[model samples]
Target chain A: MHADPIGVLTGAHFIDGDHACSEGAIAAGCRFVAGYPITPSTEVVERIAERFPFVGGVFIQMEDEIASSIAIQGAVWGGKKAMTVTSGPGFSLMMEHIGLAAMTETPCVFVDVQRAGPSTGLPTMPAQGDMMQARWGSHGDYQIIAIVPNSPQECFDLTVHAFNLSERYRVPVMMMMDECVGHMIERVVIPSADKIEVHNRKVYDGPKESYRAFETGRDLIPSMVKAGDGYRIHVTGLTHDEKGYPDMSVSAQGKLVQRLMDKIRIHADDIVMYKEEDVEGADVVVVSFGITSRTAIPAIEQARAKGLKVGHLRLVVVWPFPEKRIRELAGKVKSIVVPELNMGQIVYEVERCAAGKCNVVSVPHAGGTVHQPKDILAAIEKSLRGT
Target chain B: MPRNEIKIGGFGGQGVILSGYILGRAASIYDSKYATMIQAFGPEARGSACSAQLIISDEPISYPYIVAPNVMVLMSQEAYSKFTPELAPGGILLTEEDLVVTHNLRADVRHFSIPATRIAEELGKRLVLNIVMLGFATALTNLVGRDAARNAVKVSVPKGTEELNFAAFEKGYEYGLQLLKKEPEKILA
Candidate 1:
C-alpha cells in the first residue's frame, strides 16, 4: 500500500484544509486516528476515516472526545503512531486525557484546531486563545511538546514533526492550529515517504518475565511492551514503581515522578524548534508564532526597511518553550515584542527568559481574527524608542 | 531571479484565491517558475474582503506575502480602494468595470478595466467573474503560462463544471486582448 516505500511520494494537487491535515497524519506513518466529528476538526477525521481504510489503518469516530482520546491512547500502546484531532469544545473535554498522556509518559500526537472560544465562542472564526491553555490547561507538573503551525502547509509538515518528537522522547505532543490555517487553501508540497524518518517505540527484547514499563538507566525513559505481548504490562494512572505496580510508599512515588519529569526536563533542548531571523545588529526583536507569524514576517521587513534595526524570531515548538534562545536574545536586543492572539500567554515565557536583560512587551488581540503586521511594527517601533 | 508578485482582492466566493493557486500551480508545477501564494481570510467567508497574494520567482523567495505587489487585480470597488495605494511605485491595477464603475482612476499607475461580473452574469454564474478576472490578470502580467493557467482552472473546478469555467476564461481573455488593442503601447510601453 506504500507508494514509493523508499523515497518521499510526489503528487502535486489542490486539497482543502481537513484533507491536508489528514494527509500529514498519514505521511507521519500514523496507523490510528481516533476522533469524534466536530465541525472544524470533523473534516480531519472524515478524511482520515476515508484514507485510513486504503492505507491499512484504523479510524474510529468515538462516542465523545474522552473516548476518542482514550482509544488513541490505547492505539499508541498497541505499537502505532496514533492521533486524535478536536475543535475547541471537544478539546475542553479531552483535557484529562491530555494530562493522562503526560503522566503515563505515552507517546501520542493530539491536534487541537483552535476555533474562537472560551466555550465554542465561534466555531468558524480563528483564535489563538488556546495558546495559554495549551501550555497549562492539562493539570499536574509534566513537560510536553506543543507546536503551532500557521498555514495549511505548516499543518501538514508540523504533524509529521509532532510524531517524530513524541517517539524520540516518550511523551505526548500537541499541535495547535486555528481555523484560518486549517480551513484556508494553499499549495503544500506533499513530502515523499522515504524522506520521513519513522520512529517506533523502543521495546524490551529481554525475557518476557523481566520486562518493566518504567525502569531504565540514567536517561529515565523506559522500554515499553504491548498488552498482548508475552510481557505483563500493567500501566495505571496512579503513581507506580519501576515494576508497573502502584507503590504509594514515599520513596517509590517520589522516584517515579522525578524520573518522568527528568526525562523531558533534561532533554529540553533536543525537543524545542524555532526559526531565528535577522538578529545581527538589531535593537528590538519581534517574537511570534502561528498565523500571527505570517504578518510578523512582513512587519520585520518593514521595520528593517524603516531602519529600526529590528529582528524576528518564531517558535514552531511552543512547548518546552525556547527559553535558551530567548534568554540569549534578551541580553542582546533592546526589547522583545511579543504579538500573539491572547493577552499574555507566550509573552510570560519571553518575560521570564528576559530576566530584566531586556523588557518583554506584549501586544495581543483576540476574538475572531489574527493580529495585523502594522500593529506589530508599531510595537517594534515603540520598543525601539523606549529602549 | 525576478519574482513576479501578483496581488488579488475581492469578495470570498469570487474565486480570487483559486486564481492565485491556479496561477502558482501552473507556473511552479507545469511551466517551472517557482511560485508561492497566500490568502488572508475575513471573519465572514462570503461577504468580507478576501485577498490572495501570488509570487512567481525564478529564485527561491523567502518572504511569503508581498508588501507592495507588482500587479494588483481588484474585483470590487472596496478592494480597489483598499489595495491601489499599496502597489509599489511601478505596479498595475486591474479592476472589473461592470461592478466597480469608476472615473477617478490613478494616472501614475497603469489601469485596465474589464467587465468581469457582467461577463460572468452572461454565463449564468456571478462566481465565475473571478475566472474572467484571471484572464485579464494573465494577459497583463507575463509571469504564468496561458496554457498552464487553463489547465490549473481545469484541475480546480469541481467535477463536470469545467466547460463553463473554460468558456468564461476564453471570453475574458479575448475581451482583454480587445482592450489591449485600443492602446497596445500603454501595456507594452
Candidate 2:
C-alpha cells in the first residue's frame, strides 16, 4: 500500500534522525502517538506534535512512559496505527505495558533512542546498551522485531519498516536508535507517497456474530477487529484461548504462548535483515550494528589496507539475532569481532552462534562516546594474528 | 579535498551547533557532497562549552566522530582553550575577534580572526553571528562553495530573517576576502 500524501514530505532535505523518524512514522500511516518527552528521543515526538495536526494525526503527551506505552495499544484497538517514543529510563518504565502488548497481540511501534543508562546514566550520550533489553525486557516467552538505523535516511526508511512488521506480525516493533544516530544531522531523501510502501493490519471482514478474536490461520497471526466493530472482543494479559477469554488451563497457556513465539520463529528467515560486505573470503569479520557499525567501517578499511583479510557484517535487524547467518559466517571466517557501545551485549549471541568454530572477540565499551576506529582496527589486527 | 574535518565550538547561547549544521548542509546538500554533523551532547552542552563536529567527504562518511579537526572555529575563550590543542597540526584556526583571545601559538597553524558578533549586531541581530562566522569560515577555507553556503543560509534561517542573515554572512565574507587580498601568500592554500 502507498503512504498517505499528507504525511509524505517528498524532498531531499538536511535533517536529524529524530525528525526523520517522526516523518517515517507519519508516512507509515501512524495517526496516533502517545509519548512523554525524554532526552535524545524527545525530538521524535516534538516533531510529531508539531506536524500531526496538519496530517490529521493525534499526538498526546501522556503523563508518563507507562501511560504512553499503553495508550498506543489502546489506539491500536481503536483502528489507528500508533506508536510511542522514549529513552532508556522511560523504556524501563514501559516494560510492563510492553509485556501486556505482547500478550494481547496489539501491533504498535516503540522507538527507543538509547542513551547511557542503568538509570539515567548519561541522558545526552549515545549507547547500544539496550540491545538485549529490547529482546528480553518483557517477561515470559515472546519474540519481537527490532531494527537499528545508522543514519537519518535509515531513520526515515526503517521506521516505515517497523510499522509494517508490527502490522504483519501483530507484535510490537522496536526502532532501537542510539543517541548519536538520533541527534546527528545529514541529508535525508524522503520519496513521494506513491514510492513509499505502507502496511495496514489485517482486520476481520467476516460476520460479527461468528467472529473469534484470536482465531488463527496457518500463519499463526489472527485477524483483528477494532473495538467499536460489531464483533465482541476481549483482550487481557492473562493467557487466553482462541475466543480471546482468559483461560486458566495449562493447555490454553501452552497453545497461546507457543503460537506467540512460533509466529516469529516460523517466520524468522523472512524477518531477519542484515548487510554483508566482503565476507566471501576473510580471516576476520566484524559484526556490529547501529552507530557502531558505521564507526567500524574505517577500522575495517584500515585492516584491509594493512594486508589483513577483513570483512564487515552490519546488522540492520538486530533482534531475532540473525543466528543462521552468524553460524554460517563463523565456519567461513577465522574469527568474528563484536564491538558495541555497551560493555558486551550482542557479542554473547555471536559467541553462542559461532559455537567455538571460530574465535569470537568482544570489543566492549562502557557507553559515552563511540569506539575509536583505531581500537576496532587493533582488534581486527589481533584477530588476524590469531588466525 | 578527499575529506575535511571541521569543528565549531562556542558557549551554549552562541549558535555553535547551528553553524556546524549550516556548513554541513551547504557541503552535503547544496555542494552535492557527503557531510555529517555530530553535535556535542553532554551535560555541558546547555549553558557551558558546546561544540559540533562536521566531516565533509567526497565519498559517503564512514566514521562519524572527528578525531583531529583540520579546521577549528572558535567563538569564545573557553571553546578556544578547550579545542585548540585538538586541532590537527598545520590546521586552520578561525576565531571571533571580539570574544576569543588567542594564546599558546602553534608554529605550523594558520589563524584568522573576524569580528562576527559585531557584524551580526550591525546587521541588527546578534543571533546571526553564527551566519557571519559561517561566511568568514567558508571564504577563508575552500571547504564549501560560496554560493552553496549562501543558499544554505537562506534555507537555514527563519522565514522573514533570511535577508538579514544573508547580509550578515556577506559582511563576514567580504571582510575575509579583504584579508585574503591584503596578505597574498600566507594562508590561501
Q: Please give, for residues A189-222, the per-residue lDDT of candidate 1 as tens digits.
A: 7866766666666778899777778888777788
Candidate 1 residue runs with Cα over 4 Å from true position:
A1-9, A13-18, A39-43, B1-20, B31-133, B158-168, B185-189
Q: What is the DockQ for all candidates, taken in turn?
A: 0.25, 0.83
Lowest lDDT block of 10, candidate 2 chain A: A378-387
Give the fraction of true interface contacts kept by model 1. 0.18
List fnat, each candidate: 0.18, 0.90
lDDT of 2 by residue, B84-135 (tens): 9998988999999999999887988888999998888888899999988998
- Using lDDT as the measure, the top candidate is 2
Off by over 4 Å in 2: B43-47
Q: What is the DockQ of candidate 1?
A: 0.25
For every model in order, what is the number of clashing pairs? 5, 0
User: Who wins the DockQ comparison?
Assistant: 2
